[model samples]
Structure formats: C-alpha cells, structure tokens
Target: MREYSYFVYLMASRWNGTPYCGVTSDLLRRVVEHREGAAEGFTAKYGVSRLVWFEQQSDINQAVLR
Candidate 1:
C-alpha cells in the first residue's frame, strides 16, 4: 500500500477565476468528488473543480497552516 500525506490544495473555477482552498489526504478522489458533485458544498455549487495548486504536508496541522 502507498502512504500519502495530507495536502493543501487550491481549486479554481476557471483560469484566474475564483479559487477555493482546501485540505485532503486523497487529492485525486477529493477532486473527483468535487467534479462529479458528489460532495455537497461550496465547491459543488460554484463548480470549483480544476486543480490549480497543491502542497503536501506531513500532518494535518501543517496542511491547515499552509
């Protein structure tokens, strides 16, 4: 099994458009969920699904701080 650290990420509605900041352990899955509208919230409503930036961290605290 592959181990993954927490990730701080930014999702954009479009190029240079609205940006949504978030943290997750599974970036791929989380992004997919956002794209498919699987999780109800701001990202789903605003269609902020494109991944703009991401940073990996060792722990949740660091991910949150980033």
Candidate 2:
C-alpha cells in the first residue's frame, strides 16, 4: 500500500495577531496561496499568511479532526 501524509496548520497575520487554522496535503502550495491572497476568504481579508505552526498526520481524517 502507498502511504500518504496530511498536515494541520496554523497561520497568523502577525505575532499575537489574527489566526487561521487549516488542513492540507500540500502545505507549501496552500501557504503560498494564502500569502499571495489567491483565495477569497477570511485569511485573505485579514492577511493571515504566515505559517506559525504545523503538525503532520498519517491520514486525512486525523488531519481534518485536528
């Protein structure tokens, strides 16, 4: 069987500033999108693009639940 990885991540506008939570299999791409304001939502509106923290998960379910 093939193995897969997922991530649960936190993004912030600035230190002790607004925060955003998300899950993705492509952490780099997702963070880049947020930084470039490529999506229309809370993160873009509030500039929550800095990757403050992240945790890896063995499965998509675990990442999402986290």
Candidate 3:
C-alpha cells in the first residue's frame, strides 16, 4: 500500500496570540495559503499566519481527531 501522511497544525497571530487549528495533507501549501491570506476565513480575518505547532499522522482520520 502507498504510505500517506497528514498533519494537524496550529497557527497564531503572534506570541500567545489568537490561534487557528487545521488538518491537511499538504502542510506547506496550507501554511502558504494562510500566510498569504488566500482563503477568506478566520485565519485571514484574525491574522493567524505564523506557524506555531504541527503534528504528523498516518491517516486523515487521525489528523482530524488530533
């Protein structure tokens, strides 16, 4: 079977600032989107663009559960 990886990530506006949690199969692309405010949503509105934390998972379900 082909191995797959997913990520549970946290982004913040600043140090101990507003936070956003998300799960994605493409962490880099997702982070870039947040950084660029490409999506019109909470992260864009709240300026949550700094990558604060992340965890890797073996499956989408595991990443979502995290």
List the RMSD of every prediction in angstroms: 2.2, 0.8, 0.8
Q: Which candidate is the best by lDDT?
A: 2
lDDT of 2 by residue, 1-66 (tens): 999989999999999999999999899999999999998989989999899999999999989888
Given candidate 1, what's the lDDT at residue 28? 92
Worst 10 residues of 1 by lDDT: 1-10
Query: After best superposition, candidate 2 residue 27: deviation in angstroms?
Result: 0.3
TM, every model: 0.88, 0.93, 0.93
Cα error of candidate 2 at position 45, Å: 0.5
RMSD of candidate 2 to the true fold? 0.8
Give me the runs in candidate 2 sitting further than 4 Å from their true place.
none
lDDT of 1: 0.89
Local distance difference test, each candidate: 0.89, 0.94, 0.93
Q: List where candidate 1 sits over 4 angstroms from the true fold.
A: 1-4
Error of 2 at 62 (Å): 0.9
